[model samples]
Target: VGAGGETAHLAYNSGASTQHSPLEDENDYEESDAGSAIGQLVNGTNVLAIHGLNAGATSSDFHIEPQLIITTRTGGGGQTGYFATATPGAPNGRPETLRLPQTVTFSRSPGPFTGSFQLSITGAAAGQQIRYVMASPGGPFNADVPAPTLTSTLYTGPVTVNSSRLIRAAVFNPSNGQGGEPSTAQYLLLETGSGNNTSSFTSPLPIAVIDQHGGGGYGPGEPYKTSFLHFFNRGPGDIARLNAIPDVFTRISHKVRGSSSAHFPKRAYGMKTRNDQGENKKFELGGLAKANNWVWYNPWKYDDAYVRNAFMFQLSRDMGHWASRNQPAEMFLNVNGGKLDSNDYWGIYVLTEKIESGKDRLDIESIGSSDIAGDNLTGGYILKIDRADEDETAWQTPTAQAGSEDRIVVVEPEQEDEKPEQIAYIKNYIAGFETAVLADRAGNWATRNYQKYIDVPSWIDVHMLNSFALNPDSFRLSSYFHKDRNQKLKAGPIWDFDRGLNADVDSGAQYDPRQWNGTHFDMSWWKQVWRDPEFIQGWVDRWWELRGGALSDANLNQIITTMGD
Candidate 1:
């Protein structure tokens, strides 16, 4: 096929059959086919299509290029000429080409330094000039935007950089007023001979630099403040790449978040990525799933190892269940909204995915306001058993015993988004499950079997993980349950285990591994299921299966070693 939709046919035989063929003598073949005569040229848009039949085998390679030849008939002879480059199966080319200005380059790469140094900028062509801007770390400059309007200084000679700051530079054409994209580099100054003081920011993990634009310190309640977030890390196996450029930078609404951990010195934060207009924007940060909502988990003082929560989540995912994905990161929080320095370093934190209803998260169906009946009303709900917050809306199971104040709170379908019928459906579903559990314990397994209402494997896995970790808060606080449309209730994607693994130093009883951890707190559904012999056997069988595999001594040691390194 020619570039202008002209077609021709060339005969060849593929080496597929063992039968004798006319072209069998030749091992390599190349043939030229002349396209059909060209028609009068037109000025408007045109398209061409190329078609072929089994061009080659799966392991073979094939490519084709088509060209259009124009002929001018003179008085005596015809003159053949080639036009512009052939664009087979593509649109015609424009008369002129557009080019961007050259990018600006820095003499020194971003990194930590001990003293002031002379920095030079280059990479601008003769017709282009270099413009630059300097600001404190996590300042107002953003290099990702094109043709940003800023108070920039013209580059003439080397400049002295004495402190930690960010530098952004770009090339611009003076005649056309066109500017190329900008380049950014960060410089961090450190004290010489300092050990522990400087080592905090030089971590092997990724660094999260947050700037609140000189806002007040974050509070533990409503009204999240607008902030800027920048994440830096070179990638896997690149240990301590403190000079690496940021892999992610975006606007976020940041606020202090936690139930009991909110009072800690190093507070955890809940953030949602947003755009310049303050609308929700999803980002794939730290290699986790893309979601707007995220959490920066602050390990409690008892968890000196700082791997309790991460380990638990990893183990849960290894057991074929979905859990909140997280990555270890060091944070530099500029709440006062000035230059980021050693004092702004907030130490280690886990950048975690928030539990919600999404394909990458819980992988459940979403229920809309109109879906208040039939199979739609039966599912895609996330419920928690944590302490109720003021102004929170939740419902209590009808089968609750006297003095039992455990109210199930809906985590998804925000209270305002949930309909009355949908709430009633999930509420009654839990009540029925509770009633069946009590009835099944009384030898009514034939009909009122509790297993029929819940996913047995998921329940067993959740039970074994919490029990093995000796999490005192299991089955009560921060406990989660989720159900999908037309699917039975399932437990898990466990959360908030900083006090787990015998790390609760304040209480001796809770720290003891031998004691049943769930018993330390008020019993809920698991309490009733323990009386069922079937459930007991299932739990015991699952324990042995995991002990021989994922929970084996050698496997556990390997996992711990890998995480520590």
Candidate 2:
């Protein structure tokens, strides 16, 4: 629902267009009289949501080709272009609406409001048309209002909206538009902190203020205490005071995240938010869906080149592995409603998905008390090789038990009463695998190769990932390995890459590109595996394959450049 509508007559181009326009052709092509008809849509401001409907009769015909175009008002000259397109949803249980990227924020005009926004569509067939809806400042969709025109409005100086509004556009066939069928609505807010001083409260980053009500700062060994987390989404427009504060703070468990970096000035955090009944539940932060837990990563030691951790994870996911999905944000801290008027500027931080067992994450069977055998007892364990804190159980490897310096820690199923048996099973299994690996007899080694216990390719990829960046801490420290009762021991959901890319240490001759840090203490198992010719050939093959693909120089440079910007 909107006040007006302006049709941004779009041309269906055969290929990519240089300018940022709603009229720009989309990738979804319909074979037409002229080869293919590419449909596209662009938001004038904050694009809340998009749903594509099929023009054919059957409901199965629903497919919307969607896109986003963000324009930054550059002085008085005009707007600069930045656009992101939507990829197809997952094959199973797909989402109805395409989720747009979170970091994309509009610029604020020098006025009483934020920038004006519009919606446009292209590739409209006779039966197929798009409906655009808008919600008033901090309000729901006004069904009474007509679909607004998405005209390209140029202002005298800059364009702005007087209030925060939610705008959603839906494309559907004429027949499906009957009975006012519920359409997916996208919520867009006009944030007003765009031109403010770059500080704690006014900075353009999303603000997460935790008022622990006089509780001391989160640190290792700290218990999950009561705290109120007030999150503020800072776009270019002023923040809308819309929701009730009491209804906002979900009960959450909080603690300092990293072991080695826990002593650092700017600390990272781990959070677990619970439901109203104090049971485990899922929530969203910064566009992430169904996330009950999150990790706030601090990149202070990187000296502003904070992209290493995020980029490393991106590489992992790109290389067809599951890694934490991260979004960059400026963080602020305000404890117990302190003397500070607003949140204190922490620095640039990464709001990341926590590695855990869940449907949206590593789908694994949970451990049970009664089940001592079968797949139930054999699976769903998350183990790590990391620093052991007091009161936490740490299992020494066979090597460590035999006077070598290797240790494995149980990360999940951490309860004292529930984890002992499960930990024993995995630790023993690994011990046996190591025995097979370290045996002097070649026949014993052949029968008990490490490949029998673990996912060899996963380990190989982990090795490549760490080696490419010369990550010294690779498998030795902050290294995670998990097994789903029936599944083989997998090497990751890799965590803690901030120390890689030469960020934590000096850029000297020690970080020689010609030589790799594969000889680290953690690689004792890997060193044994190297003795196997098959393992060596597979390792070499996987390394070069990734180097030519996700880990290539050009691919890496592109990622680095994007993060630097």
Candidate 3:
């Protein structure tokens, strides 16, 4: 068989070619311009071999699909041929093999012994084909054997296999040769006695643990500590289990996230999947696309309804902007070795894309080298109007901007390593713009407008989003501004909005759109620019124009409904 699955008959130097099979070359599969492997038919058999190829160690576990075979030809005069497999075996089979559940944990209720109770089902699909396999590890039962193995109970309905302390039950997909991870090694005594009927069976969202044993617990201002995080999602074949799902080797640090909601019970974390040491491994959580670094956002303010941030982010994208991508997740902490202590329910959170300079993320230049100069030093910078933590190195504006107390922080480029000239360049550029804004004369105001320093349309869109959503801390804090070297400063990729969408503000009743002016919050320079009659009219004109399109009620309503689903 050639790399493209075309069979070629090559003259064998001897009489009958040795009978070969695809499985023989399975591990040795190699890629060419033609595909992965190439082979030729030998005497009565197909043998596959790569020319001068080194079959190095591969992590691939190729599960051949199940197939039925019928003899195409029978022995005749000097001829005996059988039908050969036409295609490479499919891994896990046609619909894909099912995987054993990653976690199975049983907890018995302490209520009065009742021989009657329901073992509830949550994740099970209504009509999906599923079966239960109960096995005792290191005992008389094994999952590797054929069905009806001794001491193992294979049932089509909900199981009551708690008789043996070590009986592990997993959802089995016989057709796909996959089974979920067996439940933990212990049995739950639902009732105090052997004859008591099994009561409740609840499938809680799988627990995830971020063990920061080296650094104790995470804090608002803490150094990055080496951490191991493991979270499970139901897949591989419809079974969910612990540790059997995704795993991430990360360096985690808890930097306070959100504006006012930073004080909420749940804290946001900044996780670096690839730290200074360059650990590039990544995992997909909640079935979201894969990425190395992530922000585990706890939307504490929104409580169980954690869609605010995801909603806001989707709105930004629909309005033709690049915003953080988010997925709702059930976050838990510190469950190691089947023990859940010092753990937290942590509740629902928005697992979001961490704002950074990367292809999938901010998509800006990454000027990380210490010796960076010229265009390299100009940007790929992620500057923000966020409150500076103690560890953050920042530059204070020479003249205080009105209404805002916090300083702008240079979030990217690790300030300590930034060249003095590079640091001075951005500082002076911002300062020069501020000076020009403050010194704008009536006639020259348009030419010297803050518009020259920023992407006016983006700023307008961001303002409209904040205004429409009535977010209290919109322009001032948790606000992000970035530029890519030669590009003008663009507003947002918007952040934290748990406080948006009619959420109450702790300071006051500031959710009213009329009361909250985008200009009045912070960046006093905005107030000076707002005074210019031309800029004000442009802001209003641009806003109303967008209201007819992206911000239109119909468009927004559709976006809300689609995203909610």
Candidate 4:
């Protein structure tokens, strides 16, 4: 497809020379800063679909999902080595020729994407090599967005970049598919890093951003865990700004875990600190995070199909992949509307090294689910949490059932038939969803309570995997095969991790499918090691900011009822 190409060029120092990209599509999005609106993709879902032929015409792209089109043509049966040919507009894939540009650059998200965001010069001959660079704000950004180059005319501004998302596309043209100064001006969304607003994706940050607290992580007494950019590697300490709307919305998603985390808190307790405004104090609210609420990524582990999105989610969350790191100041409502702070609205802001070792956890808090609710600006639902336990025999099940307050275990009620596309709809909701990175667990780390022989903090286990969402696995890995926090057995803390859905049937080592990817909730260790409190939770309260005050039970009920029969 005359679109994107390879991904993940994380080295900030290696300085690979400019390269070229011919993409299948140059998909750039303008995300809504309010509750989820129509037209925009959510929950990492794709917004583009392969357009089909007219009623009279009989073409394949119109009949099936675009992903299937790529599969049939590329992998097993019909392998057409072409660019953007199989995109929505064409089934047998349309063939187009356009004017070529002199210089080009094709950057991409660190992990994965649906279409190629490649910037390129069309009409170049087969041999001509257009110089381009596929840059990312984050080192791990190798998402599905293919590579391409920017137009020479637009490459006028000075390419300024110190951290991730600070990008510029410099490409030298060689061969065009056809040759000569072809037709068509360079696409706008996929253009060079020009103009004050032309910065597309975020780039990677320096390594030091992770250990701001001397490798202690964020938060007081809890070690490190309060940097808002823990997920993307930038924060107030680094970017020195925040976008009130986007920042709070993303943070809310991280806290709610997912749409399914909606429900009355079994109990709510203070975290020992207060918001700068002193309105929204820190606290741990307990409830179920429906099954399938895997939010955090298990990076470096690509074998599990369900967890394939681990790296993708990590990159996607950073939001700065191909954008300008120098952002303007902005403000929005906080729980304490009277008081507010400045913010940078670029994209996801991940911290470094702090949560890299996600395997650490404790008995109080098992591998916390990322069942993060989507930013509300787009009319999204509540939690779509990962399941922690299910389908266990009397002997095989863990001695403890899921819940914080009442150990009142209720066998899961038989679920009625689901409405059409319910799973797909819910899945779609989270794919484009971006979470926040705020909050710091004050009082003390889980170790504080455990060592002091204090009562189990209610926040320790607030999510409900069995009753709320569906677990793709036969049972919850964290529930049973669990151990204690000894011999360096770190107790886990909760963060904005997500579910573990495998890639589609068409997505493989080569041939790919899907418009967007789901959030990465899979853990680093598949063998139930994320229960460490110091490791996980320490980062949770701080990574993403919260959207609304608390997860409302009314919203949860409304969401459940939305699953029409």
Candidate 5:
């Protein structure tokens, strides 16, 4: 050892040694010096010196081999033995064979059926037995949790399922006392009209069936309830067609989401996929990239076409901006803990991706808690001007007048995770931008120019889209601004266009495209920037550029047709 040493003596011809032949003359030795010898092993390097006398052989025949053993136990009641290989003098082999039981397979796949069917589960070896558990219609069944021994039934023969239910089965080997991972299947009885009009309803879009356990409706606050989501569409290659078998079936925690839209009869939901232990699980849904957070947006009375939000987001992406990617889906919600029927049909909804910090989303650099100086502290933030929510973390901008609706809410990093330093940094940045905009209007461009703080092309694009659509909520609400590390502030990946595109007939001013939509509200930073001739010329130039391509009649018509279909 580097700093300490241990000593052990081997008796030459001790009668106490248990040996039979000349080659079997061996003695076992144990080191008892724990304080100095064990603690002497250093991290990087160590020197081990051996001093011994060869009593039976000459110096040329003297040889020795040492074997070390270490054992550790994991938190999950599992243990790992020695890390070294077995040698001629010392053996270090596993005590028992570790093998997983074979997976249980069902005779029929999970899907919708018209009548009762004979279900057979078959996947057991000689020492293994099958165990299964059944959940009533709309009941909870988590495949991540092992089947309970007291409640699980042993599979002895064929089981018949007549009504809708969920089944989970696993192969258990009593000899090894180990159970294989469980397999789950959902069966919906389509013949039972059960008030849910599943027999006659047909949809061109994918179908989403959500079954909430325990029957009480969703709430707007904390503590989302457990639920199951089954998505049905034509398997992989032919996604446009409808199929009896579901493409995605997993557990989720869901709750009512949105501000004013939460009161609508057709409810919107904030959902996240969860594993058996109720941890965040990511999955790709409807050809979209993998994500854990999702939104089921319900188009209410204001948007009769049910495509305003989707269309606007698509157009924003077409203009080279990253908006929320959404897919049309027909949803069926059952909160009664019974067989689903026509009453459960909740109509069409848009499954939209939630905006946040991800490579597939805003693509901003992540800021850690310790990144308080230099370029690391400069940016990668997402802020929005939205209605005040008691549960959200927001700051009042210095440029905002008292009682004004400019409560800047932090979107990325979330409310609970955002630090006070991050909030202060973003607030100071926005205040600087406002000061520069005002100074530019006052003809003081020598020091702080508005163009130095913001991405002018992004601002112009947002203005053109809002002005062209005559969106009443243009700059006032749901206005998003993001900045990446070492980058200028950029406006929008536009959101909440359900009231835009002349969707609200009562607001007649919104129907006219010539009307300045941003002026309907306080306008905030836009009002000061509009006063600059350079900004005005840039806006005009961008408008003409868009008209020649994205906003052209032919292009707009094609987009409308595609959305309509």
Candidate 6:
């Protein structure tokens, strides 16, 4: 467990062991250029890049691949192949330069509901074992201590890789734990022998990297860069119920030594009646006052915002993208380091309803910034990982993509060509930007009554929701990100004020529409929450699950825990 299957984006650890164990100690110090490699495809991949460089030596010693950090593996046998790097001081280093490949991507596995990818080492014969593992930033990691042993000694055939959305794969030689070359060479993936249809064709997954907007040159990279740091740093905060503080922090955080800081509040977000209490101030996390009062989102407890954002983090983790929730923090020396970006906003948390009706699951969409109603929860955003470092925003409207004005979060059609349209409608609905399309869907839902299924559709329609889009069950997660409707009295799942502050109408002032009729995130959101039981239940159950002991003492002591993870 020496830092294997972990991140290196952590701040300099005050308690890092002086002992240099290959598996534990050394692995913790590696790093990568995964963040830069994100290109236009996955701008939120900044976190992955930050981590790749941090895990240097251990990546080579134990062959422990950093889960989600970007490091592609490709070889011609007997020789290592080249990959992008981020090593500081090296040529093309510190963000993306030529380096060695440490991990392997999985080929798309073809399954009915779910899928998988397989790997193997090259030129290896049957019965010869090779160790491999797979993990995702959005998910968990799994390693093969007992490397896969090839039963067939002969080539049998070519190799095929499967590309699934669940996670990425990596292959390495484990030496059978016996420390000797086996009778034959082993392939890194299973597609060559018995797995593929004929082991002759190589079919990669038609991968789709979607909606990670904070960095894609389309949206703000500030908050997203901060999010990347915390996601990898905080690890996963698991929550179960309401009135309970969510443990937003996790084992992934790293604390800096001796950094004294001050507090200054500029503006208030995600609360009732936005205010500029000067309550938002900058202070060293180490010196911040402890929460004498119980926090609703304890670092130990996980909630829907936690889970939804967790999924987005995993996506960026695998893709080696960079993103964070807060502004990048600096040491007391006036020198900023470790993870975190500016304005303390990570990537937005996407919340989709799992509409189940007699064993059927439907699709719906929402964001970390949406307003919520119901009982346990009122109107406010959830699972937001604002960077404690940066405290400013340069907000603006979403890029003009087609269908940016639809408001009916619809279940993504199970057909091709229909996807873009479906997603467009959802984004508008989630943002509470419009309700025309939504009203069109369930037939004048403003005063409708529900007789079947659940209230998800109704809730969305009733509340002025907001989001980019929705899609699901497709080869990629984007298929699950668009809009759809459900049954409910008032629309909700609303919270988050960053998008409305001063730039646009929606976030600036809830009722005033100065710029072409804008949207607001405050009272307008809660106006519906007072009548919805469904909204209350979601928060109630979540807070109920994050009780005692599920949390560790180490987790409870910090203002943030991601830098160390």
**Sort order, TM-score high to low:** 5, 1, 2, 3, 6, 4
Predicted candidate 3 versus true structure: per-residue lDDT over 314-393, tens digit per residue:
78887888888876655545312222222334565667887877776788887765635677666867777767776566
Query: Residue 315 in candidate 6 has what lDDT?
Result: 27
For candidate 6, lDDT tens digit of each residue in 153-199?
A: 22223343332212212232333222122211111111223432211
TM-score result, candidate 3? 0.59
lDDT for each candidate structure: 0.71, 0.57, 0.54, 0.24, 0.71, 0.24
CA error at residue 38 for candidate 3, angstroms: 49
**Model 1 lDDT per residue over 292-321, tens place:** 999999986778788888888888887788
* Model 6 ranges with Cα > 4 A deviation: 1-82, 85-423, 427-565
Task: List TM-score per model, in order.
Answer: 0.65, 0.59, 0.59, 0.20, 0.75, 0.20
Q: Tens digit of lDDT per residue, candidate 5, span 327-392?
A: 888888877755567667788888999887788877889777766678888768887888756667
Mind giving the per-residue lDDT tens digits that candidate 2 earns over 1-565? 1211223442232222222223345563432231121223343333344322223344343334533433435588532222212345733222222221221122321111223444333333454444445444212222122332222121112223333333333333344331112122222222335443222234444556544433446776675554445555544473422221211345466778677677788988877776433457677776665787888888876535777778888899889987877766655453432232323456677888988887777677766666567668787888777777665677777466222454677766765645556767887888877776677235634564556788888888887788777776777787888888788888887888776776646555346766453464246566666667677689888878878888788998888887765
Can you give the lDDT of residue 309 in candidate 2?
71
C-alpha lDDT of residue 37 in model 1: 29
Off by over 4 Å in 3: 1-207, 213-215, 236-244, 247-262, 274-282, 287-289, 302-304, 335-338, 341-343, 370-372, 402-404, 441-446, 508-523
Candidate maximizing TM-score: 5
Instruction: Give all candidate RMSDs, comma-separated.
Output: 14.4, 22.0, 16.5, 28.1, 10.2, 30.0
Candidate 1 wrongly placed segments (more than 4 Å): 1-201, 235-237, 240-244, 390-392, 401-405, 442-446, 510-522
Clashes of 1: 0
Q: Mind sharing the TM-score for model 5?
A: 0.75
TM-score of 4: 0.20
Candidate number that wins on TM-score, 1 or 5: 5
